[model samples]
Target chain A: MALPTYAGPLERTWYYAFRTICGLIFFFLIAPLVVIVPLSFNAVPFFTFTQEMLTLDPAGYSLKWYQDFFGNLNWHGAVKNSFIIAVFATLISTTLGTIGALGLSRAEMPMKTTVMAILISPMIVPLIISAAGMYFFYSKIGLAATHIGVIIAHAALGIPFVVITVTATLVGFDQSLIRAAYNLGASPTYTFFKIIVPLILPGVISGGLFAFITSFDEVVVVLFVGSYEQRTIPWQMFSGIREQISPTILAVATLLIAVSIMLLASLELIRRRGERLRGITPS
Target chain B: MAAATTSDGALTTADGIPLKASLARAERRNRNRALLLVTPLFAFILVFFLMPIFDMLTRSVDNTVVGSVLVRSVPVLSQWDDSSGELPSEAVFKAMVLDIQDGRETRTIGKVGTRMNYEKSGMTSLFRKSGRRAKQIKEAPYKEALIKLDKKWGDINTWRLLKRESDAQTLTHYLASIDMRFNDSGEVVRQPEEKQIYINLFIRTLKLSALITVLCLVLGYPISYLLATLPVRTSNLLMILVLLPFWTSLLVRTTAWIALLQKQGVINDFLVGVGLIGDDGRLAMIHNAIGTVVAMVHILLPFMVLPLYSVMKTIPPSYVRAARSMGATPWTAFWRVYVPNTVSGIGAGGILVFIIAIGYYITPALVGGVSGTLISNFIAQHISVTLNWGLAAALGSVLLALVLALYILYDKIVGIDNMKMG
Candidate 1:
C-alpha cells in the first residue's frame, strides 16, 4: 500500500522499518538455500569460501564433488532405490488416495470427518513414533529389512498428501456434470474416465508429485524398516553426515535443491491450470 | 394396494413405493457407493498404519521376558515375601538353580537379565554369572551353594526384583519413561537424582518447541503482513521465497545450516574476515541449542507464514482505515482492529509449529548437540543404539499423547479441512 499524502512522520518511519524487517526475514528464508549452491563448487574440500572464490576466480571452483557423487557405487544404489521406491509408492498412494478423496468429498459420505482424520493421521503423527512402531510390527510379520516393507511404509505415508490435494480439487468440482453425462447415456466407467478424470487430472498429478517427494525425501522410516539393501538417498546422506563430513554431500544437496525448484515450478503450473479450469481468474 | 397406502397422505412413487422410502433408497445407494469407494483405503490404513502404532503401545507394557525365561523361579518367588528380612527356602533356591540352568541352555536368559537390568543395575551380570555356576551346583542346601557362588543371590532385594518383573504385564517401563520407578516397598517414586533424565528431556522438548513457535511467529508475522498487503503479482513472486524452503528437502536445508553455522563455516569466516573476533574465537554454533533454535525457526517459519497470510488476505482493510479515520493512533488501529482479526491465524500457526517442532528428529540430531537434543533423539537412540524397544515405545506413547492433544486443539481452532499445502 502506498503511503497517503496526509501520513505523519512516524507513519513514514514505521513503514520503512517494517519493509526492512521483512526484507531481512526474506533474506533469512532464501539465503541459506542459495549459499550452498556456490559452496558446492569450492575447489577445496572445505565448506567455506576461499580467497580466490571471493575474487570470482574460476580456479577456485571445481566439479570434482559432482563427479564423486556420480562415480560412487553407494550413491548410485541409493539413487536407484530412491526412484524405485518413490515411484511405486506414488503410484499406490495416488490410486488409493484418489478414490478415497472422491468418497470424502461426496455429500452422502458417512462419518466423513472421522474418516478424514484417520486418513490423514500419518501426516499428523510424529515420524519417529511411526518408525518405531513399524519396526516392531514389521519385524514380527517378517516384513522388516525388506524393500517391499519400505515401499509399503512410504506408500502409507504418502496417502495423506494425495487425499488432501485431490479432495481439495474435488471440493470445487460441479457434481451436475456427472449426472449430465449419465443422462446422455454414458456408462459410469465411461463418465468417470471422460468427465471426472479429465477435470481432476491437474490435482491428481500434483498430488502424485507430493507423494513422490514425500517418499523420496523420507529417511527415518527407511532407517528403521529397511536393510542396507534398501538404502535411499536421504538414508545415505544421513549416514554420510554422521560418519564423514564430505563436500560430496553438498553437491548432492545442490542437486536436491534443483529438484525442489523443478517441483515447485510444476506445482505452481498445476495450481494455475486447476484454477483456470474452474474459471477462477488470478486477482 | 392398502398395505402401500399411508394414513397421513404420504405420496407414492410410480412403482407404488412410498415417496419417503423411495428417497431413502436412493440416499442409501449413494451412501453405499461412497462407503464402497472409501473402504479399501480405510482398511489399508487400519492394517498398515494404525495397527503398527497399536502394536507399539502394547509393547510398552509387554513384560513377559522374566515370566517366560525364569519359569521355575517366578512361581516360588511370588510366594516369598521380600519384607520378611530373610532368605528364601531351599526349594526356592532349587527352583532358581534349575531355571537359570534351563535359561542358560536355551540362550534366552540374557533377555531376562536385560529386562531386569532396567529395574536395577548389575542384574545382567548377576544373571550371567549365576547362570554359569548354576549348572555345576549338584549338592543339597542349594541356598548355601547359590549364596557361595554369588552373594547377590542371597540379597533380599534380588528376590524382590525377580518377583516384581515376573508379572505378565508391568508398568516399570512406563514408570522409568517418566523417571519414576518402584521403590523397595513397590511404591512409585522418582528415580535417584543422577538417574532422572527423561522428565527433564520432556520438559526441554516442550520448552524448546514453544520457543521455536514464538520465534516463528515473530519472524513470520511481518512478512505475512507484507505479502498480504502487496500487489498480487509482487506478492506471488515473493511467495516463492517461502515455498522454496517449504518444498526443499528437509535434509538439504539442514545441510545448508551446517555449512552456515559450523565453527569454521561461512558465518564465522565472514565474521573473522571482518575482524569481529580472533580466528581462534570462532563461535561453536552447530551441534548446540542455538543451532537447533536458529535452523528450526528458519525451517518452520513457512508453516507460520502461510496460514497467517491466508487469514490476513481475507481481512478487509476498511476496518483499519475506518479506525484511523476515527482518530485512533496507527498502533491502536493495527492492534485493536487488525491484530484481533489475526488471532485465529496465530493460534493455528502456533499449534501447528509446536506439534511439528516437538516431534522433530533429523534437524536436532544433525545440529543439536547433547544439550540441544530433543526427546525424539532419545527415542531414536533407544530404538537403534540401545535396542531398548520397550522404553522407546513408552517414550513414543507419551509423545504421541502430547501431539494428539495438540492436534485436537488445532482441529478445534483451525479445522483440518482448512490445512493447505504449498
Candidate 2:
C-alpha cells in the first residue's frame, strides 16, 4: 500500500486523492448489495433501511423469510425448474459454442469473420422480437408451454456469450499443440480431449458459467414459452412484484446476490488457473 | 497425417495421398467439420429465433381478414362511394346484414379493426358491435341503423374503417406505427396535430436512451479511470464487485431498485427524515423519468465500467507521468493524457448501454409509469395484450432501425477503431 519511490509531495497528495475517489466509487458500486445483506437479516416484516438500533440487532434478524422461501412449494418448484432449465441450457450452449469456437478459431476456413459475426448475432438482436416469433411458431408446433421449449429458447439466447468468451480464449491458443499430439499417433479425438480441451478449459468453464447465468436470469423469453408449471424463479418474482410488493422478494433477491457473488468468485478463480495452465500471463 | 490415414483410410492411398487430388478436398472436409460445429447454432437460431421474426413481420401485410371474407360485399359497397361519398350502397348494407346473420364471416375485418384500435383505442368492441348489427340495417331505417351504431361511424371515420376493409393490400398498420393514419383518399396523414403518437414515442425513447447514455458516461468515466490506475489485485476485486449484479437475475435487480425507490421505500424515508420534503410531498422516484434514469444507470453501470476498466488497464502510466514531469498539473495531465485514451472505452460503453437500454422492458415497465414507458413496453402490449403482431412488428422494426442507426452513428462519431472492448 506504500507509495512508489518516485513519489513527490504533490504526487503523494494526488495518490491519496485518487485512492479516496476510487474507494468512494467502489462503495457506491457495492452499496446496494451491501444494503441488502443486512436488510435480509431484519426480523421485522417491514423493510426499513436500518433496524431499531444503531448497534447490531440479532433479535431483528430471523431466518423466517429464508425458511419461507425454502418451505413454500411455489418458490421451491420455481427454484427447481430454474436450475433444471439453466443446467440443460448451459450444457447445450457451452458444448455447441465450444465446438464452434474450436472450428472457427483453429480451422483454416474461408470467411471466418462472416462466420464469427453470424455466430454472435443472437446477442445483438432484441429478445422481444425473438420471443414474439417463437411464441407463434411454438404455438403451431404445440410446444409453446413445454419445458423443453423454454430450454431451447433460452439456450439460443445463451450461445453467443459462450461463443464470445471461448473465442477470446482461443485467440491465445496454440494450434500446433494439437498437431503435435496427432504426430505422436494419438487419435484426433484423444488429442482434442487431452490437448485442446485442457488449454481452453478456463474459457470453456467461464463461458459455461456465463451461459448458465444468462439462462437463469432470462425472463422475457420464458414469459413467452413457459406456462405456470414451467415458471422459473425470475418469472415467479416478476409476477410477485406485479401482483404485490412483497418483502419476501427482497429475501430471495439477497440470497440470489450471495449465490451470484460465490459463482463469480469461482469463475475468477477458474480463469486465473486457466491463465496459469496455458502459460498465458495476465496483466 | 498418421491419424488421418488411420481414421480415414478408405479415402487415402498407400502413399498417404487422399483420393481427392486438390487441396479443395481437404478444404471441403474441413469446411464440413466447421459446418458440423456451426450447424447446431445456425439451426437453433433459425428455427427458434429467425423463423418467428419472419412470421411476425409477415403480419404487417397480412390483409387476409379483409381480402377473403368481405370480397362478395365490396361490389355493393363500391356503389355507395358516390355523391355524398359517405354511406355504403343500400344493397351492400343489406348484404352486410346477411353476412352478419350467417355468422360464417370469412373476412377478419374484425381482427384488422382490433389491431388498429389497440394503437389508438375504441376499435374492437366498437367495430364488433357494429358489425353484428348489419341485419338491423335492413329492418330499421338507414339513419336509425347508423345512429344506433357509433355516431363516429355516422361521421367520415366509419367510412375510413370500411375503406380499410376494402383494400386487399394495405400498409395501414405500418403507417399507424409511425402515428400516421390513412386519409379518406388513403394517403398518409398525421394523427391529428395534438395527440401524442408513436412518432413522438419513437423520438422520446431515443432521447431518453441518449440521456441515460450521457448520465452513465458522466458517472462511469472517473470510476473507470480510477479502477484502471489502481493495483491489479485491488482493481480486479473492484471490477468483480461491479460485475456482481450482472450474475444475479436482472428482474431481481430491477425490483430491488423498485423497493428502494418506492414512496415508502428507503430513498423516500431518507428524504423525509432529512426534511428534504414533507412525508406527503411527491417522492417522484418510481413511475417517472427519475426512476427510469436511476434503475437504468444502475443496471447499465457495469457495462460502462467494464469497458473503461479494460481500456484503462492497457494504458501505461508513463503518459500521465510524462505530462506531469513536463510541468502539467495533475488534473491537466489527467485531462490531457488519461482522458483522451479512455474515450474508446467511453464510446464502447456508451453504445453498449444505449442499445441495451432502448430494448429494456422490465426496468422501464416496473419503475416507469405512463410517462416513462419505452417502445419495448408498447411492443409487449401489442403482442400480449392486444394480440396484434403487425403493429408489434412494425414498432419492433422501428426500434431495431433506431438501434442500428445509433450503432452506425456511434461508429461515425467515435471511430470504431478506438474501441478496445475486453
Candidate 3:
C-alpha cells in the first residue's frame, strides 16, 4: 500500500523497518538453496568456498562432480529407478485421484467428509510410521524388497495431492456445461472427454506434477520396503550424506533445484491459464 | 402399465410410476455412480495404507512370541499360582524341560528369549543356557535337575515371568514404550532411572516441535503480511522466494543446510573470515539441537507463510484503517485489529507445523546427531538396528495417536479441504 501523505515520521520509520525484516526473512528462506549452486561447481571436493573461488579465479571451479555423478553406475541406477517409480506412481495416483475427486465434488456423493478423510489419510500420517507399517505388512505379503512394493507405497503417498488439487479445481467448475453437452446429443463418454477434461486439464497436470514430485522425492518408504535394486535419488543422496560427504551430492542437489524451479514455473503458468479459462481475473 | 395414484394426490410420471419414486431412483443412481467412481481408490487405500497401519497397531500388543514358543509350558504353567513364593513343582519343571527342548529344536527359543529379555535383562542367557541343558535331563526329579543346571530356574520370579508372559496378549510392549514395566510382583512401575529413555524422548520431541512451530510463525508472519499487503504483481514475484523452497526436495534443502551449518562449512568459514569468532572457535551448529531448529524452521516456514498469506489476503485493509481513524495508535490498530483476525491462520499454521515437526525424521537424522534426534529416529533405530519391532510399533502408535489428535483438531479448525500445497 502507498503511504498516506499524513503519515508521521514514526510510521515511515516503522514501515521501512518492517520491509527490511521481511527482506531478511525472505533471504533466510532462499539463501541456503542458492548458496549450493556455486559450491556444486567448486574445483576442490569440499562443501565450503575455496580461496580461489572467493577470488573469482576460473581455476577454482570445475565440472568434475557432475562428471562423477553421470559416470557412476550406482547413481545411474538410482536415477533410472527414481523416474520409473515416479512415473508409474504418478500415473496410478492421478487416475485414481482424479476419478475420486470427481465423485467427491458431486452433490450426491454419500459420506463425503469421511470418505475424503480416508482418501487423504496417506498424506496426514507421518512418513516414518507409514514406512514402518509397510515394512511389517509388506514383508508378510512378500511385497517387501521389491520394486512393485515401493511403487505401490509411493502411489498411495501421491494420491492425496492429486485428490486435493483436482478437488480444488472442480470447485470452480461449472456443472451446467456438462448438461449443455448432454442436451446437444453428446454421449456420456463424449461429454466427459470433450467438456469435463478440457476444463480440469490444468488441475490434472499440476496434480500429476505434485504426485510425481512426491514419489520422486520420497526416500523413507523406499528405504524401509525396497532393497538396493529399488534405490531412488533421495535414497542415494541420503546414503551419500551419511556414509561420505561428497561434492557430487552438491551437483545433484543443484540439478534438483533447477528441476524444482522448472516445475514451479510451469505450475504458475498452468494456474494462470486455469484462472483465465474460468473467467476469474488474477488478483 | 397401470397408473398408481398416491392417497395424497401425488403426481405420476409418464411411465405410470409416482413422480417421487422416479426422482428418488434418479438420485439413487447418481449416488451409486459417485460411490462406484470412488470405490477403487477407497479399496486401494484400505488394503495398502489402512491395513498396514492396523497391522502395526496389532504388533504393539501382539505377545504371542513367548506363548507360542513355550506352548507346552504355558498351558502347564497356567495351572500354577505365581504369587506363591515357592518355585513350581517337579511336574512344572518336567513340562518346562519338554517345551524348551522342543523350542530349541525348532530354533524358536531365541525369539522367546529375546522377547523375555525386554522384560528382564538376564533372561536371554538364562533361556539359552537352560535350553542347552534341558535336552540332557531325561530323568525324573526335574526341579532339582533344572535348578542344578541353572540357579535362575529356581527363582520364583522366573516362574512369575513365564506365567505372566504366557498369555496370548500382553501390554508389556506398551508399558515399556512409556518407560514403565511390570516388576517382580507384576505391578506396572516406572523403569529404573538409567533405563528410562522413551519418556524423556517423547517430552523432548514435543518441546522441540513446539519451539520449531513458534520459530516458524515468528519468521513467517512479517513476510506473509508484507506479501499480502503488497501489490499483486510485486507479491507474485516475491511469492517465488517462498514457493521455490516449498517445491524443492526435502533432501536438497537438508543437504544445503548441512553445507551451510557444518563446522567446516560456509557459515563457519564466513564467521572465521570476518573474525567474528576465532578460527579455532568455530561453532558446533550442525549435528545439534540448534541445527535441527534452524533447518526445520527454514523448511517449515513456507507452510506457515502460505496459509497466513492466503488468510491475510482476504482480510480487508480498511479494518485497521478504521481503527486508526478512530484514534487508535498504529501498533494498537495492527495488533488489536489485524492480529486478532489472523488467529485462525495462526491456528492452522501452528498445528500444521507442530504436527509436521513432531514427526520429522530426515532432516533431524542428517543434522541432529545425538541430542536432537526425535522419537521418529528412535523408532527407525528399533526397526532396523535393534530389530525390536514390538517397541517400534508401540512408539509408532503413540506418535500416530498424537498426530491423529492434532489432525482432528486441524480438521475442526481449518477444515482439511483448505490444506493447500504448492
C-alpha DockQ of every model? 0.83, 0.49, 0.85
Off by over 4 Å in 2: A1-18, A50-58, A281-283, B1-21, B74-95, B104-127, B130-160, B165-169, B274-278, B407-422
lDDT of 3 by residue, B147-265 (tens): 99999898899889889988888898899899999998899999999999999999999999999999999999999899999999999999999999999999999999999999899
- What tens digits encode model 2's per-residue C-alpha lDDT throughout A1-283? 3577877898899788867876776676666666666666667665556546235766767778788788889898899999999999999899988887777775665677666655665666677767777887888888799999988888888887888788888888887887789889999889988988888888888888888888888888888888888899998888888886566777898988878978888987887798677676864
lDDT of 2 by residue, B1-422 (tens): 33245474556555666656535677888788877777777777777767776777776666666445555555566656534655665556556555544433544547645654644467667657766665566574555465566665566555556655565656767887887876656567887777547888888788898998897787788778767776777777677767786566777678777767888777788888889999899477789888888788878888888887778878889898799889998789988888898877777888889988888888788789988888898999988887777778788877777766876666665543233222
Q: Give per-residue CA lDDT, model 1, range B85-143, as digits (tens).
A: 88888998999889888999999888888888888899889888988878899878899
lDDT of 1 by residue, A62-126 (tens): 99999999999999999999999999999989999999999889999999999999999999999
lDDT at A152, model 1:
91
> lDDT tens string, model 3, A1-283?
7788899999999888888898999999999999999999999988999999999999998999999999999999999999999999999999999998999999999999999999989998999999999999999999999989999999999999999999999998899999899889999999999999999999899999999999999999999999899999999999999998899999999999999999998999998898888788955
TM-score of each: 0.98, 0.88, 0.98
Ranking by lDDT: 3, 1, 2
- How much is B105 displaced in model 2, in angstroms? 6.9
Output the number of the DockQ-best candidate: 3
Query: How well does model 2 score by local distance difference test?
Result: 0.75
